[model samples]
Target: MELTVLGTGSAMPVPERVQAGYLLDDGDRSLLVDCGSGVLGRLSGTGTGYEGVSTVLLTHHHLDHVADLMPLLKARWLAGEEHLEVIGPSGTKSLVDGLLDVYEYLDGRVDLAVREVSPARSFSAGGFEVAARETRHSMPCHAYRFSPPGSDRDPTDGPLTLSGDSEAFAGLAAFADGSDVLVHDCAFPDGTDVSNHPTPTALGEVLAGVDVETLLLSHLYPHTGGREREMEESVRTAGFDGEVRVAEDGLRVDI
Candidate 1:
């Protein structure tokens, strides 16, 4: 699986980084994760017009992570595209229905499907086998694990776990343990005194004992400036031997 970080900034979008969003592709098909306000523009910047997104999976109903849902759908609809699939946490169907109600134009322009997901359940979106897990956070957020078909116990094609905005908690290890890559929210720098969202030091402890291949930190705040190296070193001190790195907009990774 490969991932494209569309936007890595948090609730307040920075000039260079928009809100939270990403594009996941496995050569044959592509899926979107989080559609922040500027996602479509970012997709255009990637040089691939929004023509064939296999599906969209939202972490929660938070506006920063979902602001671009209608925009993406409208753009695709106007271009004569149809059959869009969207999956999300328990309130996903109602969220979409509310949006559709507000934007009446969305009613007949596209054939959209919605699936409200729960933790520990498995589903297939496009060609990916997906699993969901609830996380400790302010909103009804979740962490998702994505796996492609025809894979072994080996991590060469192991799951990619995306930990939506969450506080550092024990529940995360099971979702991240022995995974290929962990894209977690390291919203604050170490010793930054935070809760309900993770600081690098706090979140690192949860991942310390996990058997993941790489740690790609995202959902960064502007205050996290210039502490990338320090954060990686802290996670290492927590016992994570795998590679660790900060996620920047437009960065891509494959495993």
Candidate 2:
């Protein structure tokens, strides 16, 4: 399995980073975890064109997280790939309809299917056994854990988790308790008390007991610039003895 960071910025745009997005590829299978602003272009930068992505797993309906949703669907259509499977939170279907409504010309140009997922449930999609759990965010958000289909390996062994925007909470930690790679939201550095987002101090406490092979801190803000080492050390101070790395756009990891 390979993981690629398409974009690493939060809602606040930074020249150095784009919005939140990622791509998970396992040989012939590919799953796009999010389609935020500038993601389509970053997808191309990863050398995996838009046509190769047929499944998109959206965490929430935030603009920064879905600004390019319609553009991606249309790009695929232009590339002769008309079918897409979009799974997201409750209002996903409605959001798709609303997005397509704006671009009336592309309404029926592509075969887009949307699934609104429920928290604390497991489902199958695109060769993945996915588990979804609700997170403590201002809006409805779901953190996802993805494993290869039909393999009963322990969750700690290989399942990769994407922790959507949330404050450090036990529910989210439990969802990602034993993951191979946890791409968590590290919106800012420590001493920042913004709600519904995790700083290193807060996330360190959350990950203290979780057994993750690699902690990939993502969903960064401009404030996180030049503070990567501090973030890693904070988590380490909390007793998480795992490899911690900050996520950057176009970062590709093969596992």
Candidate 3:
């Protein structure tokens, strides 16, 4: 499986990064997670244009997470793609309905199916098995863990987990306990008063005992600029001794 980071910025936009978006491709199909602003444009760079992504799994309805959703639907429709499936938390249906209601012209332009999934549920998307866990965010957000077809049989096999947007907590760390890559929302650096998103130290503290192969910090804000090394060091000092990486837009990792 290959994972591509589309956008790494948070709600507050930064020129170098976009918003929240990631593409998980399992050769057969592609699954898009969180189509925030600038994400649709970033997809074009992945060789999997909007039409190539038939299913989009969202973490929440926050603007930075779902901003480009309508644009994606319309792009697919314009490209003559027939079907699109959207999966997300409880309010997913309403969110889609509301978008279509406002953009009435795009209604009925494509075969759209929206599924509302609850936390702790497991589902299949893009030929991969996905497990969802609730995140400790201001809104009802969900972190997702993705594993290729039979990886479940081998607990040590590589799987990818995304924290969506949340504070660093034991539950979230445990949920990503065995992932090969945990792309968490380390939105700020140390010494920043923040909530609902983790700082490097806070994230590393919870991840101390987790057995993830790589902790890829993502969802960065402008404040994190020029301090990437410091952030990594803070995480290391807090006790996580695994490989640490800061996400960059368009960076791709194979698992």
Candidate 4:
């Protein structure tokens, strides 16, 4: 599988980083995780257009995370792509309704389906087996674990995880345990305590003993500037012996 970082900024847009969005591609079968602001354009910049996205999963309803939801749906409609099935938290149905209601003109012009997910449960969507666990964020948030359809064994050689915008949680420690690659929230650099989000220090501590092949930091806050080296070292100090790289928009990583 190949992991692509479409946008890695958290709550704010920064140079080369837009918002929290990513794409996990296992050959042609792809899953889009969190369609935040700037994602539609970023997808094009990455040379991976939105037409190939068959499924989308949102971690929460935060604006930085779901800002471009409707735009993406509309884009697919205009591009002649088939309708997409969206899976999200409990309020997802209502949120989708509200969004469409605002753009009521587009209603019925496009076809869409929705599924409200149960926390800490596993479900299937578009040939992917997904597991979700709640996370500590100001708003309702979830961390998603995805594996290929009908196979626990990863087609890309191992498992892949997307730790949504979240604070350090025991749930996530358990969420990504034994996975091949962990795409975690490093919104802040080490030593920055802003609550409901994970700084590298706390994340490193929690992941110190966990079993993971690599750790890639995403959801970067603007304050993370000038501390990139420190953050990388922090994860290393906590016993994560695999790959650690600060996310950059449009970067593609093979897992």
Candidate 5:
């Protein structure tokens, strides 16, 4: 399976990054996680384009996380794609309904289906098995653990877990335990007073000694500029000694 980082910036925009979006492709199918601002255009760069994605699994309804959702639908409609399935936390349907309500012209332009998922629910999308867990965020959010098809039967295979947007906590760490890759939201560097999102030090403390092999810090704010290495060192200083890297747009990882 290959995971592509489309956008790594947070709500605060930056030239170096966009908002939250990731594309997980397993050859036969692909799934989009979050369709934030600039994400739709980034999709085109991946050779998948908007037409290549039919399913979107959201982490939450925050503007930074769902800004380009409607644009994606419109793009797919223009591309002659007939169906789209969006899965997310409880308010997913309402979010879609509201967007369609505002953009009346886009309504009925495509076959759109919104499915609401909750924590502890296991579901299949784009030929992958996904496990969900509630996250510690200001609003209701869910972290996801994705396993490629047949990987469940392979003892050596490890799933990829995405922390979405959340604070650093033990429960979230446990949820990502044993993952081959943990793409988490480390929105700020250490010493930046923040809520709902974690700083590098805070994230490191929680992830210390966890079984995750690689931790890719994402959802970055512009403040993190030039401090990328420092952030990684902060996490290590706090006790997480695993491979740590900062996410950038277009970076692809194969697992």
Candidate 6:
């Protein structure tokens, strides 16, 4: 499976980084996760135009995570791709309905399927099995794990986990354990009072005993600026031996 980082910044804007977005392609299918601001444009630049996304997984309802939802749907509709599925946490239906209601012009332009999922929900998307769990975030948020069916491998081998936005929730560590790649929310630097998001040290502590191949810190803010090395070191100091790196827009990883 190959995962592409489409955007890495958080709610606040940063010229160097776009907002939260990720693309997971497992040869037969492609899943787009978190289509935040500027993500549609970034995906366009990657040669995978808006129509390339067959499914979209949203972690939360925050604007930073779903800003481009309408744009993407509109683009696909305009491109003659009428069928699309969007899976997300509760309120997803309401959000989409609200958007469509506000922009009545695009109401019947596309056949959009919006599925609302809870933390306990497990389903299939883009030919991959998916599981979600609740996380400690300001809003009702969920972290998702996607696995290849019938694969006798730990998450650290091929499966992937994405921690949407949490403050190092204990359940999240167990939920993400053994994943090959964990795209975690790291929004601030050390010593910052991390509320609803993880700092470098907090994330390290969360993964101290977990078995993960790589921990990709994402959803960055200006507060996390220029502390990449320090963040990695902090995770290492917490007893995790896995690779730790900050995520950048356009970064791609294959497992």
Instruction: Report the CA-based lDDT of candidate 5 relative to the real structure.
Output: 0.90
Return the clash pairs for model 5, or none.
Answer: none
Model 5 / residue 159 / CA error / Å: 1.7
Model 1's alpha-carbon lDDT is 0.81
lDDT of 2 by residue, 1-255 (tens): 788889999888787789999898877788888888999988877656788889998999999999988889889988999799899989999998888888888888888788888864577666777878888899999888888655686433447998889888887887787787899998989888699998887788878868888998899988989998998898788767788988888888876
- Residue-by-residue lDDT tens digits, candidate 1, 1-255: 678899888887777778898887777777888998788888777644577674789999889898989988888888889878888998899998899999997887888989887875677766777778888788889888888654443322256888898997888777678787889998888877787788777777777777888889898888877887888788788767789998888988876
TM-score of 2: 0.95
Q: lDDT per residue, candidate 4, 1-255, as tens digits?
A: 677889989777887789988887767577788899999888766545788886788899999888988888888888888777788888999998999889887677556888989654578766777778888888888887777755766422338788787888776888788888888998887666588888887888888778887888988888988788889998888766677887778778776
Q: What is the C-alpha lDDT of each candidate?
A: 0.81, 0.85, 0.90, 0.81, 0.90, 0.85
Off by over 4 Å in 2: 149-158
Ten contiguous residues minimizing lDDT sum, candidate 4: 149-158
Worst 10 residues of 5 by lDDT: 149-158
**Lowest lDDT 10-residue stretch of candidate 3:** 149-158
Worst 10 residues of 2 by lDDT: 149-158
lDDT of 3 at 98: 95
Candidate 4: regions farther than 4 A off: 150-158
- Per-model C-alpha RMSD: 2.1, 1.6, 1.6, 2.3, 1.7, 1.9
Candidate 3 has a TM-score of 0.96
Each candidate's clash count? 0, 0, 0, 1, 0, 5
Decide which is better by TM-score, 1 or 6. 6
Q: What lDDT tens digits, residue by residue, belong to model 3 across residues 68-110?
A: 9999989998899999999999999999999999999999999
Candidate 1 segments whose C-alpha is farther than 4 A from its true place: 149-157
